[model samples]
Target: MNWNDLEKHFSSARLGRYRASCGGDEAKAATAYVNNMLLSEAMMPMLNVLEIALKNGIHRQLSTLYRRADWWEAWAGNPAFAWQTKEVVSAKAKLQRREETATTDKIVAELTFGFWSSLFNGSFQSVLWKDLRLVFPRCPKHQRQRHAISSALNQVRDLRNRVFHHEQLLWLTPSLLDLHTKGTEVIGWLDPKLVPWLARYDRLPASWDAFQPV
Candidate 1:
């Protein structure tokens, strides 16, 4: 496609916005850079590991708090807790569709990243975080507030959804890279092994240089 046609697909107003932040008036360069970052094999695995760590990490904490592995049925299954029940049912449906044996770990693995991320939302914020805090052993040592972690996770969730939906992130450039870093750190807090594994193949460390203005 010609430059004008390409620009139409990406939108000139959006390109202008990126130019304000990134400098230069090269819409083609900006669009190419954004497309490259989107197509790169970095963020997806990081998000995958992140979602796994979140569900597993949170499941561990919840199990301890409720003193049972099947805590979801007791804690989330009720008329008063219908939202949580819906999330659980959705997770189970995913588990069943895959034709794999259903277990707590597998069910947690099948759960959407949104499910774990939503634990910090308005519905569960007041009570959930207290139990959830114990899993992030490093957070307290660094004196990082629970609310900060909640906000960071929510940010990752937003970024994850945007990327998966093929939306614009180039305008977010510097701050977008910061969110990727936050994602890895959050994964580390949950599972130390996952950090090194994710970093081994991660391209963002090098990929980010292209996003900065010359």
Candidate 2:
């Protein structure tokens, strides 16, 4: 959606005209602004998950990363890390990995695997490969396995974080409204009875209450 159209869909939401730096990266200011807004759409669910996790003793884990969550983070590779993972006290291993995220492919691989593994249980390969691997179809033959997933996940994470932070959604680009609407499925997960609110946000998909993240 164009800026005006985006403003129309989201009342009171405005694109940050003046460039605002995120993590001191001036080049990413504009995209970061729009992403900041769009990502908020994910918050209702992420926060719901946070609540569920909190009620189930997960909030204790958030205060200070001690387990897998804090174990394998790549500090400089992600901008939102500034906000989300900054509290994590790095150990010798991660600091070494941090030093290698860009230098050695092996380091990037392990760090990438660790990052997603922390997000979800079980092995990290499937989730990372499925969501991030295919993003760079044209990557050089060998580089595809190593760089593509990391690069795609990083870029997507930045955009996702921008939206998560509620900065701005539609900036000055084109987005698949169909895909955007699919977010209602997520709402369904949070509240199986939120069809009305989903419709209010124009996120209710055709199947409606049939499935979450529909």
TM-scores for every candidate against the unseen true structure: 0.75, 0.27
lDDT (tens digit, per residue) of candidate 2 on 1-214 = 5544544665422333323324434345544544443445533443333223212222233213433433236455665344324333333367566674433234333332224324322233453344333333334556545343344334434444555545444332323233243333333432445545445544223222222211
lDDT of 1 by residue, 7-75 (tens): 688777755555555455566556654654554445787887887777778898888877888678885
lDDT (Cα atoms) of all candidates against the true structure? 0.72, 0.38
- Poorest 10 consecutive residues of model 1 by lDDT? 32-41
Clashes of each: 0, 17
Worst 10 residues of 2 by lDDT: 205-214
> How many angstroms is residue 156 displaced in model 1 relative to the true structure, after the best TM-score fit?
0.5
- Top-lDDT candidate index: 1
List where candidate 2 sits over 4 angstroms from the true fold: 1-39, 42-87, 90-144, 172-214
Give the TM-score comparing model 2 with the true structure, all chains together: 0.27
